[model samples]
Target: VGSASIRPPATAGRRVPQGNSCNFGQGSRACVRLRGHALFRMAVRNAAPAVLGNALTCHVVAGCDVAAHAASGDTAGGQARGQAWKGLILRGWLRGGLPCGGQRCGSMRAGSCQGSRADVPMHGLLNARGQRRRVLVPPPLLLPLLLLTLLLPTAPPRCAAATSPTTRPEPSPQQAAAARGCSAEALLPLYARIDDDLRHWAAHGISEQLMDKALATQTTASGEKAIGVLFESGVPYVVSPLEEIDRLGHHTGLITAHLRFFEALRETFGPSIPDVEFIVGTADQPAIRLDRLENGALPYPLLRFCKSETHADVLVPDIHFQMRAFNATLLQQLDVINSVAWGEKAEELFGRFSQYKRIIHEHIPTLEVHGAGGENICHHANFELLFCDVREHFMKWAHGVRSSGAPVDVARQPRIKMIDHARYKYLLHLDGQTCSSRLEQLLVMNSVVFKEESGYHAFYHHLLKPGEHYVPVWKEGPEDVLEALKWARAHDDEARAMARRAQRFTQNYLHPDALACYWFTLLGRLAQLQRFEPGRGRRAYPVVLMASEYLGSNAGKAYVQKHGLSRMELPRAKRVEQRRA
Candidate 1:
């Protein structure tokens, strides 16, 4: 039989129909309103699983029906039955059976089984009717099951305890220290190896011997010892019997002796020594013996050599006819010093140093000369005094000029005018304006030289007149050195300022620390390559050093081809002359 209930009565009565409108008033006629049957149908569908689940629960717990019934409905019998059914459904869901609503049961059932169902008494659904047929569901079961339905494991709430910061494992102090030590150990070996190689090179004859000698003569014990070995053997002293004997012959024997010494040093030192460099003059042709070597064989401390000229060329107009000629000559002298000191090319080294000195002489007055006589001296003597003073002034000027990027042309006229007025007057009218600090110094230095010519005014005037040849007089004095020092001290503040500016400029563009970092990074890359691939080593290649102006010149290309080196592999060549300096 279907369960039925009576509908509640309405207060108002129905009215009679008038024209087209008819009103059915409340309570006027017996109205039979159907209670919502759809809800009952859904409940029946949901309850079927619960009923089946209850039957299974009855098998497990026969007396728990009273509690289930009470929780499911208000009536004692029904509540007891419903409660028992609810308990059964929960148990079934826990065991992976279908839900009470026939949905697929999930992991939520595990929590449901572990909830507070045991606390609720089974007899609580009994009423005054004394009906014991209904099931009484434990209150805990109903509430926890309802929660389980909402809080199922399909999307379980994140466990705060699991994610809490306190649960994370902290690193042990010993482990952290070990890690740091490992990093340091890895870095230390690399740096140590590099330092060891450099030291080996220094201990052998790789460093400049003449430089070593100069340091030995001028510096402390440590400095002297720092390059002592370099000076002892590999270097050929300029005044040696070999130099006299060889004269115009090939210096290959000298070079080969040095190479053999280097080879012996490397063999004695084992793998630490990298290679030996032999710098020679471009005109010098060394003996070549390619057939003596085997393929893939390491040549005992491989030989790397370069050719550079170190002496001043009289034929080069740029050096001979340019401004600051005397200053240029002095610089040429320094090149001789460096070559003797550093085993540099004679002509090339001299040329660059001369150029540098000329620049400096044109800008600063570090050297000066004074005559024994006053303004009343003969014209020739006065001219000599004037020429010496001008030469001194320009020498100092050139130092300052060379330190900057100024052109070396501006100081020529004043240089020539002060030395011999007649030969170089044509240069005076050309480009009167000076644009650089170096140029300004050149002019100021020239002014000082002009002042020194006061005694030689008549001779200079006569020489300046058209078609008269000017004969330069040369003089030497002790006070000139003091005068040069005074001039240097006077411009010391400006020099310091320029030096600071240059330092700042270098920091921005050519910082040594940044360069070190780059080198270290490159080293790391090389190390990585070596580690990843064994047996593959750095290739032996020839390097060509050419002047910047000659880099793209045909002669330079020809030289590259002659050496059997690829143009592509060529590093941007710095001036070999500059390197020597």
Candidate 2:
């Protein structure tokens, strides 16, 4: 271990500092004079533990040569001397003794210790030669004042640990409203009910008397009264004139046209008039009112509509025979003209005519085909060549048949063999003629020409009238004509077979009851009435009846029960109800 030591001065220097170390250990009050003019320097070499109840003082002089040597960059020799000097000062203060004044001062006394005043050094030995140098004193007397300066109030400990700011929120009106419940509204209209017997009369052309009798005994659902009538009839009309013309001949045209016209009229006028049973043909017979017309005649009649209110009748001409004759004559003339104009080798002419004939055969019936002999006779005449002459002749023939006689009343005529045949044939001819004429008129009005070379040509012909401005002209070679004619013949056979089948179907299934049901449904819807509601009030509900029947064995009963409606019988007197205010 290396031992280090610090030596004190023997005499006081020329200018002794007040805080310099002094030596005072001998017993007398004599001062030890030190002569060397060296400075008093102190350095702390090690930090000592602070003594309790002691005041520590550190003094640093401006021009002192205090040299230190530390082993670990801390507490070196000079620093240790400084620390020791501080320790000595602190020890003197703690011991309540005065500090050593200077090298020339008297030795320190033991009883000369009291308070902080004892820590201050006297000024007598602060100069050389023991001269008095204004009696300088250390600032230990101001120690309490220095401590007061360091006791400043620190910031509150909790306040030093604060953070940021805060905020708020809002609401939505739409969200609040949705939480409750709200919606919109609307409005509708109402209708009145009619008498059951009258309702049936208005719908199916049935007698009100029958309906009244049936209803008088008929029972209804509990809490509900019957206020409408139900008529059961099955009738199917030839509704499509074009289709009818294709199936039937020109002779059926009259009836076909009438049917079309009446259907149109009903569409236009039926909605406006209530309580009207529009009838077609003659309604003078009791069977007509009774809804007892024989088979096909009742549904597809030559007459159109019969308005009960005005007793008005719309008759459609029955010209089936006329059209058939017309078509036959025209074809014959065309063949004769082709044979004559082109001679035996007139292949082109023949082909053209053949094509024309094909169109005719495709649309018209075979009985309407004219023979070749007649065609040659009128070949030179323009009208004859064009077959107009044949058409005129056929028209005259139709008129003759119509004017011949009143053979049998359609409704009253029973379905006996000869009688039914006559009625069916006559009606068929009439319907065919009506359809053919309409087609012909339409063609002519449209300026459509039937020329072999031109095929079917149409020109703008305002003079031909609005509905009949388009015409078809045929154009084909002789070969084409022959082929077309053969095709037409084959097709005619097929059409006849289909027609026969249709007639059978109509006779078996399409009855008066069926027609009554169809008409009831149609009129009910037109009148805006509801189907019979049995559980509902006696007030009549506007309904539109559909033509189709309900399924199941008890279809009729089920319909009434399910729909909650009541039905009145037929042939009843009209009921009189007081008008509501």
**Candidate number achieving the greatest TM-score relative to the actual structure:** 2
lDDT of 2 by residue, 129-177 (tens): 3333221122454444324423543221111111100011111222211
> Which residue runs of candidate 1 sit more than 4 Å off their true CA positions?
1-257, 260-269, 272-490, 494-581
Candidate 1 lDDT over residue span 1-581, tens digit each: 01222111120121111111111123111111111233222222122112111111111111111112111221111111232223334443111121222222111111001112222212211122323323223345344643453344333112233322222333232232232232234333323323322221233322234323323342122221111111111111111112122232233223222322322322222122112222222121111112233563211211112100111110000111112332333222333322221112111100011112111111122222243333221123232211123333444444454366322223432333222221111111110111111211122111111112212111002212211111112234322323433443365444334323332332232222222222222222223222122111222112121122122346434443443323121111210110111
RMSD of each: 35.8, 49.1
Q: Assess each prediction's global lDDT (C-alpha) against the native.
A: 0.23, 0.23
Per-model TM values vs. the true structure = 0.15, 0.17
